[model samples]
Every structure is written in C-alpha cells, then in structure tokens.
Target: MSPLPEVPAAAGVYPITVRWSDMDAYRHVNNVQYLRLFEEARVYAFKDWFGADRDLIDEGLLVVSQAIDYLVPMEFAYAPARVAIWCSGTGAASFDLGYAVAGPEGDDTVYARGRVTLVAYDLLEQRPRRLGEAEREVLGTVRGEPPALRGDRSAAGSRGHR
Candidate 1:
C-alpha cells in the first residue's frame, strides 16, 4: 500500500466542559479520559452522518484497535475543547479512523491525536467480517486526509509489533 495522505481534520465541535472529575492528582486531564473525548466526537459524527437508528455500536461492532499520542496536557482551564475526527484506509475488513483534539478557535495545535481501526463482525460467524455495502458507503464518504500515525513510521511499527 502507498503512504496515506495527511488527512485534514474533520471539523467537529463537541461542546465539552472540563469537569473536576476529569482532572487527576496532577490537575491535568487524565490520560484515559482523552480517549473518551475522541470517542464522543466519533459517535457524534456517525450519528450526524448516518442518523441514530443505524448506530455503529448497535451494529455489534467494537473498537478492535487504538493508538493515542498526547501532545499537550489539558488543564482544567482548557475547558470546552473541540474534538475532530476523520477517516482513512477503508480496507476490505476494516478501516482506520483518526482524531484530533484542540482548544476552541479550531486551531491545529493538537493537544492529542489518535487512530482506531475497527472491523465489522458477524456475531453468528464469531469472527471479523468484510465491510458491508452500507458500511463501506458511509466510510468512503469521509473526504480529506487522515491524521498521521505518531511515533514509529508505520501503524504496525507504532503498535510495537514486528
């Protein structure tokens, strides 16, 4: 496969306010909570594009893989950050989704970035399955480049596997 393009950040504004609970003893947003922000943006994007009925989660799909790169630690003062998401690599059985977190004003001074690969599954078959027509249609519609993989050059290398 060729190198993936630099996927432009999909503009998504999830009006989230920093809560006390999000802060850790160090007073920065917990590392794990940043993942939640990414999820929230993705869920909203899917619903906004495909409607709530055919929800991705309800389709019995789960995030099979994820990678996050923390750029700047979010403090309590950085409330109401916007989360952006985009897509790339709609492979036969799976696709790569990317995310970016930034403060308001839609800046690209990324506070965090992530990529998640998810595969469609047939519960009865008890294994991963190819992307369905409807699913492919939805994923293919995502335009622009995908966020870059952090750390090692390739996604697999970044995952620390040979």
Candidate 2:
C-alpha cells in the first residue's frame, strides 16, 4: 500500500464509539451514518473554536451542502474511532469544514472523508448574511494546517482560506 499521509493537526477531534445501531445487516456502519460522524466532529470543532459564539446559530450558519467519500468500511468498535475535523476554508458568507474518520489509532486507516459547507444566514430577516470581521477572525483561528487527505472532488483541500 502507498504510505499514508501525515496526520495534520485538527481544530478539534471527537472520539466516536460506533454505536451498535450504527451497523447495518452486513455489520458495517451504514453509509448515511458517516454524515453523523462528520457532524459530530465538526460541531465539536465549532464549539471548541467559537465557544460563547456558539449561540450564533440563531442568526448564523446553516449547512448548505455536505459531501463524503468512503474509503474503507467501518464496524462498531469498543475502541473509539477518531474523527478529526477542521475549518479548511471560508468564503464571503460561507465556511467549509473538513473531516476524516479513522481507526482509533490514527488517520492511517481512514474510513471516510467529508466536507460541510455552511452559509451564514439572518434568522430574523430570513436571508443569507455576509460574514462579519469577528466571524472571519474566529474561522481563521481554527485549523491553519493544510488538508492531509486529498480531496478528490471538492476544493476544500486548498481552494480558499488556509
């Protein structure tokens, strides 16, 4: 096998003890469950970076899109899986979060990779909102490390703010 890529530092990491219910008839994690795994890690990253700003949810970002790549099938395990996540980039009114779900040991056995694009919104006005200086600064404070996994489809790997 090709040597695995480096484990880039993440903005946040979540330990995922795959639930019994996460498995399908084949005993592998259901494909859809991967989204949840990504969500868990991303949310943790948001909380870690934003802290009090977490309340911005009311008039802040919403997931405009989410996409994932499955590399290896995963099974429920007592040893928690490691879901490493970070803010890969950002735009005028949106930010992209990157994720890697891997075996507890590390990213060498990556099970899946994903990106979630969140668009800022005005909850009261019912429309999109431009990012403020504060918001931009917060996003910049997250992960500055370059993406470790090659993003085969999206530009989250290196298209916007690093």
Candidate 3:
C-alpha cells in the first residue's frame, strides 16, 4: 500500500499548564505525563466533533494505536504550554492524529511529538466498523498529513501490538 499524506500544520492547539503532579523524581515531566497531556489536547479538540453525545464511544470511535516521541525534558511553569493536534489519514475504519507539545507562548519550543490511530468500532458486536460519510466529513476539516512523514515514532513497546 502507498503511504498517507502528512498534514502541513496542526489543526488546533490547546494550552496546558504544568502541574507538580506531572513532575517525576528527576524534577522533570514524567514520561507518562506526556501521554496525559496529549489526551487532554485531543479530547478538547474532539469535543466539537463528539457534539452532545455524553458517551463518546456511542459514535464508535476508539483508539487503536498510539506513538510518542519525547524531545526534551520539561519542568513546571507559570505560563501555559501549547499542545497542537490535527487529523491526517482516514481509512475505511480509522483515522490518524498528529500532535506536538510546545513551550510557553513567546518561547514556543516543541518538546514532544505524538500520533494515534482511532478506529470506529461496534461495542455491541465487539468488532471494528467502517468510517461513515458523516464521520469522514467531520474529520476532513483538520485532516491532511500523516505522522509517518515526521518519522512514525509511535509509543515504544506499547501494551498492545498494532
């Protein structure tokens, strides 16, 4: 199969304040905390797409894969850091997201990169489902580049295989 195209820029950016709870014994942001930050940004961006649906999975979106790259260690700061995320590739049953975390405004340095694949699924049937036209259109607004163009550094040794 051919490779997917990459999104030229982040579709949306979310501000994240570093908290004491996010730091590790090394006095730097914990590795796991990066994933949490990505989730925060992704969830916030998707709220519009999810609409009034309290149960997000009611529409069948489920995270099937994830990858992240840590570029620099970080510490707590008063200013809010920015997490930029965007949709890229879309398939019959899934779509991909790309993300980057940057330092506070002005400084605005990127410190991490991430990607995830979300698949439509049938909870009752316990199986994957295809992306519908409405779902594709909603994702199309921010969709463009695939993360592989940035090196495809997904999470290493994740709990589940892709």
CA deviation > 4 Å runs, candidate 2: 1-7, 106-108, 144-162
Q: Write the per-residue lDDT of candidate 3 for residues 1-162, one digit (tens) a residue.
A: 111122245367778777888889999889888888888877788886656664355556788877777878877788877887788778899888888777777655667878888888888898998877877787888775654423433433444223
Off by over 4 Å in 3: 1-10, 50-58, 148-162
lDDT of each: 0.70, 0.73, 0.72
Per-residue alpha-carbon lDDT of candidate 1 for residues 93-129, written as tens digits (9 for 90 to 100): 8877777777655443567878887887777777888
TM-scores, all candidates, are: 0.79, 0.80, 0.79
39 in model 1: Cα distance from truth in Å? 1.4
Candidates in descending lDDT order: 2, 3, 1
The 10 consecutive residues of candidate 2 with the worst lDDT sum are: 1-10
Worst lDDT 10-window in candidate 1: 1-10
Tens digit of lDDT per residue, candidate 2, span 42-157? Answer: 66666667785565565566898777878889877777788877777888888877777887764468888777889999887878889889878887766444344455425564
Q: State the local distance difference test value for candidate 2.
A: 0.73
Backbone clashes for every candidate come to 2, 0, 7
